[model samples]
Target chain A: MKITFAYWGNYTIAFISLFQKLGINVIPPEKTNQQSIIEGAKISPEMYCFPLKANIGNYLTAIKKGADTVFMVTSLSGSCRLRYYGIIQDKVLSEAGYKVNFVILNQNFIDIYQKLKKISGASFWQIVKAVYFFFKKLHLIEKLEKKAQYLRPREKIKGQTDQILRETFPQLEKVRNLRELTKLKREIKKKISEIEIDSKKNVPRIGIIGEIFTVTDGAINFGIEEKLGKQDIEVHREMDVTYHLKKIICPWKDWQIQKKINPYLKSTVGGHGRDAIFEMLNYTKNNFDGIIHLLPFGCMPEVVIRPILEKIHQETGIPFLSLSLDEQVAEAGINTRLEAFVDVVKNHYNNKNH
Target chain B: MKCYLGIDVGSVSTNLVLIDKENNVLFSLYIRTEGDPISAIKKGLKLLKEKIPENAEVVGVGTTGSARQLAGVITGADLIKNEITAHARGVAHFIPDVKTIIEIGGQDSKIIILENGVVVDFGLNLLCAAGTGSFLDAQSFRLKIPIQEFGKLALSSKQPTIISSRCTVFAESDMIHKQQIGHKTEDIVAGLCQGLARNFLANIAKGKNIKPPIVFEGGVSENLGMRKAFEEALKEKVIIPKYNTVMGAFGAALLVKEMSPQKSKFFGFGVIDKDIKCTSFQCKGCPNQCEVIEARIDGKVMARWGDRCGKWSNLNMNNI
Candidate 1:
């Protein structure tokens, strides 16, 4: 079966490698753009979350490119609307007269393996190796991204880190084995480190915590991470595809997040609501200058947690900027808010020092 | 006779203020932007030259507001700050103990929370125009009431009517419906003020710790009715500083005074006569398609910005 999945930053590369290793035909969704969002929103319900619309758009674009089967990661139980996205997306697609099969995977490892076995006819050991390769690449990409975040704000030349990262992603795709991957990792690290960065520049450090999709998707968030980096603010984002996968594979992380956020939030609000609070608290304790919470318009979990985050801000005296984004959100509006926010944080820092 | 110049180029109005070494306002001018910020700054500078003392020399310059970058480039400002910081600085200079600042301008409204003369938090209206000064101005025009008399009419009402300020369209329709019901004009005006104040409090000041010693500044603060509405809504007295309309410009001037940069980037008031031109084009280098803006002075490119990749911006750096 020809399969396709939505893009989540560079995570698509790992997915392609895994599917290729299993000898399955995988059609990656077209790069997200204004056309994709417009197409996705045209058929989607008005109040559905942005990720759903974008994901549906991706599937439609993939289908147009000849993908007959779609793969989606779903949850069985959650207050977040994400769990219901699979059924709604399937219904929406079929109603649009597209005949396609959808393979939905939950947190169950055995269930995913069984589905893959039926689809790809791959040996159990080969499937395991593919999964191993997927994770290894994911970890490597995450490391590279973290390094870029550190270097972007301090780079003597603007956009140098971005330029290096843009070139590194394709190079990562060509790696075949552990030895090759390690060598490439070192080479990319050296290349990124070689980018000249001003050592004396004292930049305000910002931590971004929010919904997974909006946090990872640059197009949707208006490239906020890059915008902050361009403003010479060191932005550290904790949510990524690999981080989400790790939490899914190991449920103990959720327990720890729950415990840390227990005093503020009594129960899970579902999705990343609990996790957002945990991450904000973590950043606050670590002496980060500011916390930016990004959520899609009408996201229930995030909406529920916003006030709590504000309360944390009041209690800690650390500035918190909550940006709710929709397709209608203007780039100028975002830029102005970010500029004002950066000013507030910098002024606060300067005042504290004096 | 050394002076520091501050220019605030907002969407609705462009304000310029000049201050001396003692931070006393030497001269101030407020003019309608009319959608042309460069021309507005030039006109303001011309007026400044005519009004200021003959011997006064501009030693430092600062720019603030939405068009700060454009103004900074044209004026060669020593510092370019956002309206939030500028407004807060301007007010904190006058009211050092202010804990909250409610600034409602023509196109946007913001709430800045301060502590001990430092900004701790701020919120700006996003994609909403209901609680801003332009909305009130538009309503005044629709009602055939002079904009200057709007506040007086609102204050005279004994019982304000209830108007829905959730959206501008809804509020206009609601006002018409109230008028049809034979409600007095003053009552409707007061109700609109209350609705706007409520909207500002609900959205911009939502979940904010608005304490005492709140200073309200901006063009909208000139309306006593809106100030009363805010007072009634927050159940706390709000102080409107003397220079409410030009607070942003005043703040910018104060910030530059505080910094007192060793080398001022002021290009002098002669920039008012220079032939400055700005052009924009979309860059096709990547998918972002950033609209690169270029500013030219006397037909020579001085600055290029708005590119996401910094490709064009780097080129302008060499020119500088």
Candidate 2:
């Protein structure tokens, strides 16, 4: 069966490796763009979150590209709209007259393995090996991304880190085994370190926190991380595919984070709102120069957390900027706001020194 | 006499201000952009030449506003700063104890919160024109009243009607409905001003701690009705500075005076008569087809910008 799934940063690489190892044909969705967003928004409910629309667009594009089976991950326990995305997408696709198989994975790891075996006729040991390779590749990409973040603000030549990171992705895709992966990792590290950087530049540190989809999706947010890096601001974003996977695997870690946010947010408000609050507090304690909270427009959980964030800002005297994104947001408007925010943060940082 | 020149090129208006060594305004001009910033800036410079004393020399130059980059390139400004910093600086110079600044310009509005003479936080309206000066300008035309006299009429209203300010389009329809229901012109006008005031408080100043000694400046600050509405809504008096219309330019001049750049980049008023042209083309290097802008003087490219990758920008770095 031809299988397709939405792309989420570098996690698509790990998924491709896993399915290939399992001997199942995989068709990855095209990179997100204006076309995908338009197609997705056309079919999605008016009030649905941006991620849902973008994912729908991805699925539709994959279907047109000859994929008959669509795979998606959903949460069974949360009250968030993410839990309903799979079923809603299924209904929408069926109504659109597409003959496709919909495979929805939940928290049950055993169930996922059984389904994979049924589809690919893979043995338990093969499945375990495939999973091992997937995790290894995912972790490696995560580490590389962290390194790129640090290098981006300091690189003497603008866009040098991004260019190197883009080039390394293909090399990563060609690796066949653990030895090759390790060698490739070492080579990439050496190349990235060779790039000239100003070690003495004192740049303001900014922590980005918010809904996972809006924060991590470059196309949706208009390349915020790159924009900030170009402005010589160090950006720290903790939300990523690997981090999300780790939270799912070790649910207790999320509970520990939730504990820190208990005083502000008593109960789970669904989605990533709770996590955003926890991360904001952590960044504040670390003495970050500023914080940017990004979320999709009409996001219920994020809207609920806006007031709480204001309280936090008032109490701590830490500057915070909230950006609500949708299809309608203009790129120039975002750029202007970011420029002004950087100026304020820089002035505040300089004033503190004297 | 030595002076520092500052230019604020906004969407609707372009302001030029020259300040002396003692921070006193030497000459200032406010001209309508009329969709051509280059000509507006040139006209202002021509006027400044006639107004300033023959002994005055421009020692430093600064540019601020939405089109600050373009203005800086044309004027060879020593410093280019955003409107938030420029406005904050201008307000602080007038009111040393000012803690909040409410600036509503042609297309955008902003709220700047300060503590101990340094900007602590600020917010800009996101692609919304509900509470901006342009919205009020449009309504004045529809109401068949001169824009200047619109605010004076509002002050005569005994009881203003309640109008929603959630969106400009919605507010316009609401105003039409009020007119159809036979609401008094003065009451409707007052309602519109109050509606804009509400929109500013709910959107731009949302969650912001606005304290006393707040200064209101920008093109919209000229509306007496808006000032009174803001005062009534917040239960606090809003101070309108003397140079409210040109505060951004005034602030930019003040900043350049403080900076005291060793070599002033002031191209001089003579550069305004030069033949400068700007054109843009889509770069096809990647999927993110950035529209790169190029500025030329006498057909020789002088500046290149708007490319996110800096590919084109780096090419003209020497010229800039």
Candidate 3:
């Protein structure tokens, strides 16, 4: 079978290596940025959810490049209205005059191997090689992201961490061996630390929680991390769609590194607020100055967690700013909150020092 | 000698279950909610106190369902669990090989997917009212038939019509049209069941891969007609457990029993009859104006919640 892999952002290198190992065509989406988010939301359903619009936008761009198939990971349980994402997007795309086949990879679904067989038309050894490479790329990306987080607040100039990350990402795509990948990981980490951060200034550490994809990807949050970076505040984010899906596939053992952060806080097994509640307590106990919980509009799980988190803030006296993103994720609105939050955290530290 | 108490407080029904250390069911009580959760809980507690053995010391108490928090504070619950975990645990305990759970309760419906005793994927509908038990109850009321008899009535039908199941209003209007066309009540009831089944399939069951050995429970599980409709739609037999109605309560009790018995954080049985008052105030901390609800017991704040950011209620340390 002739297959074309479609994805958003810079994940093209990872998919290229994975799909190439299987003798399949790996197609990259248009480079994602702030403009793509606005354009995507405008073209798609106004209320379909954030991840959906961005993903749909990305895939639509890739399909324009003659890509015939889109691969999306769907989790079995969680507040990610993302379970029905592939089917919904598939239908919506068809309605909008795009003819493309969508391959949904969900842990809950049985016969995944057979489904892959149907999509790839690859030999047994070839499929195994592709999967092995895919997982390897995943591990590399995770390592790179972890190092990226530690660098963001510490950088001398705002966007330095992002600049270093952007430069280092392409170098990772060239690596072929596990030893090479390990060295690259160490290099990223060391490079991140070398960027001068104020050692004497004890800035308040704030966490951003809620909605796996939107929190991690800068396109959805509109570079809020960079805004916080300018204020010398270390921002910790704990949601990743890749980690959520990997955890489902490997329940017996840890599949992602962040699991070590809080092993007890699992995904909402019932599609509820348990993850938020557990994370809230963990963030509070860790003595973080505040938390910024982000969620999509009409998210049921976050709706339930709102009261619990409000209670957490009440108990811990932690300043929390909750932002619910939908289609109208304007740059001005985002920057206003980011600037105010940083100011509040700055004032908090200043008062504590006195 | 160990005793376990399980309570499920839902929007429409309150259920209580008593199980011994061996997990043997000793007593079960299910009652209507009537909008006042506190009153329903009081009635349930009174019935439980009267029915259970006086000397049987309740070693552990567990609460589940939508009102699990409120029930936990009032009943001194040792464990508070969500409906999904409770249902999955209860089903796994009773039938180890259970793979799927289709629970349709009052005001809500859920689909639980389990692989090797752990929940892999689950879906619930709290937004829509089309496929839930309350939808069936309202339809039954509109048809002037008791809910229990509606299932049997549906089974007697020969031909069932395909009515609009997207919205409740559309379904009711379609049902009225079918009635005017001289259709049999049994057939119309059967058609309604099919409509609900179709709605569940289109909405909650979309993109879900349903496996066999499915267990159907909750208030709507009593509807044999709906069970047949689902079986026919999926081309697989639906399995209904012995104590399907109280599965959430049973699941909660089982979870509590799994833990080492501890002093329950329960407020005691006196809380059942006590005049509990609830008041709300708009928080002026910011522009959000989050309405914080405070529950007072004997003029003391026992529990406070309902804020969007926890600025107001998180300050109350007396209850914690």
Q: iRMS for model 2?
A: 1.9
Per residue, candidate 2 scores C-alpha lDDT tens digits across A77-156 of 77788788789889877877878899987756877888889989999899999889888998888887777778788999
Q: Residue B115, candidate 2: how far off, in angstroms?
A: 0.6
lDDT of 2: 0.87
lDDT of 2 by residue, B102-214 (tens): 99999999999999888888989885899899999999999999989988999999999998888888989999999999999999999999999999999889889999988
Scored against the true structure, residue A68 in model 2 reaches a CA lDDT of 95
**TM-score of every model?**
0.93, 0.92, 0.53
Expressed as tens digits, the lDDT of each residue in B1-320 for candidate 3 is 56788999998999999899899988998999888887888899888877888667688899987777677766668887678778888888877888888988998787876666655445566347999988999999999999989999999988987778888999999999989988889888999999998898887765455888888898898998999999998899899998999998998888889984766565556766687767778776632244577777767777666553345555655644
Ranking by lDDT: 1, 2, 3
Per-candidate DockQ versus the true complex? Answer: 0.54, 0.51, 0.01
lDDT against the true structure, per candidate, is 0.88, 0.87, 0.73
Q: For residues A32-140, what per-residue lDDT tens digits would candidate 3 score against the true structure? A: 5444555566667776767777777777667767888877766544345778887887887788888887788775635566777666688788778777766777766
Which residue segments of model 1 deviate by more than 4 Å?
A60-64, A94-101, A156-158, A174-180, A197-203, A351-354, B269-277, B297-299, B317-320
Give lDDT: candidate 2, residue A35: 66
Backbone Cα, N, C clashes tallied per candidate? 0, 0, 5
Residue B12, model 1, lDDT:
96
* Per-model B-chain TM-score: 0.97, 0.97, 0.94
Provide all candidates' interface root-mean-square deviations: 1.8, 1.9, 18.5
Full candidate order by DockQ, most accurate first = 1, 2, 3
